[model samples]
Target chain A: MTVGNTTTQRSADATATGAAVEIDQVAVRFRTKKKDVTALRDVSVRIEPGEFVAIVGASGCGKSTLLKLVSGLLRPSSGQVRLHGEDVRGPRRDIGYVFQRAALLDWRTARRNILLQAEMRGMPRAQARQRVDELIAMTGLTGFEDAYPNELSGGMQQRVALCRALLHRPPVLLMDEPFGALDALTREQMNVELRRIWRETGTTVLLVTHSIAEAVYLANRVIVMTPRPGTVAEVIDVDLPVERDYGQTMSAPEFARATGRIRDLLGATTTAE
Target chain B: MAAQSTIEQPERTAPAGATASATRRPGGAGAGLLRFARNTWRPAAVLAAILVVWWLVTAADLVKPYLVPSPGTTLDVVLAQPGYFAHHTWITTYETVLGFAIAIVVGVLSAVVMVYSPTVEKSLYPLLLFAQVIPKIAIAPLFIVWLGFGLSPKVVVAVLMAFFPIVISTVTGMKSIDPEMLQLSATMGAGPAQTFRKIRFPAALPHLFAGLKVAATMAVTGAVVGEFVGANEGLGYVILQANGNLDTPTLFAGLIIMSLLGVLLFVVVELLEYLVLPWQASRRTDATTTTL
Candidate 1:
């Protein structure tokens, strides 16, 4: 992935290829009419290339804010968020964001929404069309490509959203509680699909979710965050093997242990706050 | 998502109120027709009863024939001078259409400007509301003063009347977009123009069409009001001359023709909405069913 802004040199260990994110003492403040609210404070983390990282936190823990900072959607009030080796100044084409809701354009058909990436980039029509067909197939949305968003079920709509995010093949993917809206069974199934896709594409992913099970099931490392003026409370590494299946992962002892540890950390943070 | 039941889902129900008989499962074409007639007959019966009461009133001379012409006499007048009514209808139709077209362009452009800039919205929104409060009928004569007694004055009045609703609805539609949708677009590297073209505009279309339907009927009234003040042609002029001469049948004929013009325009707008926003039309649920 090509980095931006040459003024700051790359860190010695950061690579020239593969998407890498470095959050250096990042902070975000909202200046409201009544007072200044610190959304995030001195939050620092690094995501290596192709690593699947999940952040688990309560509502006001600034998990979504961190994702925004990484995607260059929000500027850090202090320090910097770097993609690859360069600082992120604004939105770039190399990052993909999947919102909590499917958020598909209701007017556009499923295929057209996926091709929105190409439309935004001014990519060649023929190439975009070919890519759209492949993504529809990849996301198991073959027959439903022409369907409007309202015609699809909630889970199907989220699948369409996933296809749209992955259409441009961005080096880094950021997801904010993507499966949180689905029912339990569908959410588990989608978790399986997401893991399979991540394994296949080897794209670096940073997912923020409120579900502890989801964070442990999907990521190599789960970042537990504290609430209000949010900062990282603990980073728990998942010792489970990379080749995880929904059924097997849930039953595994290591999975239980990792989730239990993160849960305890979260419980303690909320009480202390 | 796992497929549920999968019995083809009954061909997806038509938009709400479009198919009251659509719920009935019919064994044959005859049954389908009977069901359709059953759903439609109530309204038809009410209309027939009203007509009967009117005829009885006329026969008993409850009201003067000149003041309130019998429905039959109005029909006869309409049949007698079809060409004259048609000429005036065409003129009124042109003015309404032209004014509506101009309103759509100017209103939507203004809405876009206001949506994109906070300063413009703050300054212009109250003024738009102010313009909406002043009755368009009151200003119809002023348009004639500036543009003279021609098609321009009538068209101007129609535009002034139709413009506010379109702008209000368009602005509402643009702002109603989910914040997540905007954030997703930003992450996709979409510039302002691209976001508006592909996302905001298309999403706003259903609301825009809703406003257009209201504006379409308003346009006809606006044109007629302008004609009421000063015009040599149009159904409004026909009505005014007939009223002066106490030609009640001709006046009633003019009123019918003018209203028919408005209804036709409204239907045309609805058809356009269906074509452009099939997704929205198809997704509508029955209003009663949607109550919490």
Candidate 2:
């Protein structure tokens, strides 16, 4: 725990936790009025402990559906999603989920919103208070504890949302396009912040993003997914250095190559669609 | 053309910081008063103009005084017999408040039930609709027959009149929660009760208040309607009594008092809304201004 000090060194004192994910040939078919639409087909990917993985694809390519499956919000039509070698039968308290929208309760202030995790999990009040303070500082939301979600900016609201998600120090953090709604500049800033937090907390992150560049910029490995009946198209390693800068990372050759490859995969899918 | 260009340019200029500044600008009590005055003045001026026109028509003897009393005559009646109206107003207010309370509790609980259980909703939705379709005024006399012409029938009528809007708005509010938020709550491992308290109920408040404001005014109408059917006291009774005696001024005085009661109740609801949902109201203003 040192807050806002961007470093690659892991917190040895940080709670020993990282949820490894194994997607075993999972396929999801949603039965709607019109048809039994297959969202994912044979999507098998094993994420290592403490790894930051980004899944990127065109809209409707089951990127979010895959995240849902892992988070136990949805069960696959076939196969299984396992966390830390344990089957995900239902929503696991050990995993944190961040939605696309900040989804902050409009009535709750930033501090109250962050404390929601403690309230839900019934964490000891004093300890949860200490954790919330640290998280608020880490997320750069120190002065905005009393500010309502509507009072905060889009980026600030998302920061509160992130704080709420991480307050419980969950082993796995699943994000579904968390910064997709933000503008380009804010989104980039959030990316840097997210990377710093990930580095500090050492929590395993499974991020679903539509932006190819974003996927490369944050994740250790980018899982490119195909359109419609989405499965892993390619698992491209982001071969950039671990110590990354938002402005400098984009210009790195490896970054360019990784993003470029993901872009082509996405482009191919759109044409096929 | 200039306005359109200005609007287009703000998209480039309106950063997240703009909203913070916008809220901070309205800082002091003076600014608040100014804002209130700015909003209120136009309607106040229109009302004044209408009164002036009304006074002129009456001064010119355009209508028979017996048929429609002059504003001055009505005001005089209100002033001269303050005790007469006060007693009736008190009775009506009590009935309205009690009925409104009943409507709110029943309506909200029903809304929660409907939202949580589809089977209950499927079973009761048609019956709820049927209740709404029946003219409450037509059944007011029936309530009087069943419950007698005391506060009971009046309260029942008020509840009938006020229930629908509260139920409808609450249902909409409860259901209006972003699906993603619910999913996030689920993934947070919140039990159903915790999720409802933390997310669903708070989200529903703005919509509930909208319904409450409507129901508050309707409650007064319901109370008065019940009195109109059968009552010994209340503004409704006064109006009916005045009409029987052809005392037009007293009738107009009763009308004014009833309207005042409705306005007063509506204002109270609005104040409660401001207290409960400062975030919601402020957000709307910020959203509109940021577009500019």
Candidate 3:
């Protein structure tokens, strides 16, 4: 990926491409009219290029808040967030965000909705159209491009949302519980599809989800988190084979051990909190 | 509208009311026509039943003829004075249409401003509520006194009556957009103006059309009410003149024509909505027929 904003002096990392995302001692505190709430504290992660990282936590663990920090949608109370060695001062056009809800514009057809990113960024029309077609084929949304959001099933709607997010070919993709609303079966299918898509695109991904199975199934490493002043409790690495088949990956002992470790860590964190 | 705003779901923005009240797509040309027929049969049957009841009440002399004219007598009176009735109908129609047009422009503009600025909304919303509660008919004569017996007074009344629903619905639509969408827009580097144009305005349309349908009927009520206060012409004037003459048939005819005007305007607005918002779920229909 051609990193924009070349002005930021490149960080020294000879073995790998400089970190795609760097969160340095991050913290977020929401001050409402009443009490003050520390949503996250001392949270830091350095994500390398093309890495898939999942953050699994309880609802109040501020995992979604972490994703927002990376996307420049939320500013940390103290520490810094950087993308491609440049500080994230505002919403970065170089990143993509997928919300828990599909959030598709109902007035636009699926193709047009995907093309919304292009419209906002003022990308060249022909280039954008070709990219849209490629994404449609990639996402298996080929036959449903002209369909409206309400006509599509929930899974299909989220697929359309995924297509929209990937249209610009952002170097880093941030997903905040994207499949949280889908049924178990569809969620499984989407997880398989997402893994394949990530493999094909090689985009760095930061996914925040509440589903433990989903977290272990899709990420290189899962960051288990604790609530009540949200903090990272543990990071469990999955050592399954690269070509992870859905059934095979689930049956792998490494998957079992990693998932078990995560569950125990979460159980301890809940009581400790 | 306030109560509905608290219960805001994406579904809340769906064009709501009548099967005809609104929502999604249906199939091809022939099928759409067929669906239209199927939908209208119930309302047609209701109209037929009402006509039958009216005839029964008149023929049985349940009330004095001067008080409640026979449906036949009312129809005859209309048929008798095609020119006179048509002239009055045209005047009222023009007034209602003009008022509705002005209300839509003003209401939408104000709604945009109010949605963008909390200060404007804060200052104006209570005044809007107070104006609505005061009753247009009560102050309609004041419009006549200020604006005179010309069409402007009646048009002004129609505008006043139709304005609130449009403003309320537009505001709701503007606010109903998912916060995630705005975040998405920001990520794409869309400025505030582009966001409003490409997102907020289009999002507001379905609700705006709903408000338009409501306002369409209200505008007619307003015009007639304004005419009631002071006018030398229009259907409201015709009704008053017929009542004084004790010509119950003429009075009944005027009432029928007046309501027809309202329904006609409503249907026009509905048809416009259907054309403009084919994307709305209310209008969606799948193709069940065999296609080549």
Query: Whose TM-score is greatest here?
Result: 3
Best DockQ among the predictions, by candidate number: 3
Model-by-model DockQ, in order: 0.30, 0.31, 0.36
lDDT of 1 by residue, B153-242 (tens): 999989988999899999999999988888888887788888998889988898899899999999999899999999999988999999
Cα lDDT tens digits, model 3, B181-282, are 999999999999999999999999989999999999999999999999999999999999998999999999999999889988987886676556665523
For candidate 2, write residues A27-124 as lDDT tens digits.
Answer: 99999999999999987777777788899887898998998898888999998778988888997788888888888887777888888889888899
TM-score of chain B of each: 0.82, 0.87, 0.85
Error of 2 at A259 (Å): 2.6
Estimate, for each residue in B1-292, the C-alpha lDDT of model 2 and write its tens digit: 0011111111121243324422433222344344445666787799899889988888899999888778999899989978988999999999999999999999999999999999999998899999999998899989989999789999999999999999999999999999988888887778899889889998899999999999999999999999999999999999999999999999988998899899889878876765556666566666767898
TM-score of 2: 0.88
Comparison by lDDT, 1 against 3, better one: 3
Q: What lDDT does each candidate get? A: 0.81, 0.83, 0.84
TM-score of 1: 0.88
What total of clashing residue pairs does each candidate reach? 0, 0, 14
lDDT per residue for candidate 3 within A1-273, as digits (tens), equals: 323221222342322338888877788999999999999997767777888889998788899889888888889999888899888988999988899999999888788999999999999999999999999778766556666676677777888899999999999999999998988887888899899999999999999988888998899878888875887777777777778999988888998998889888888887875
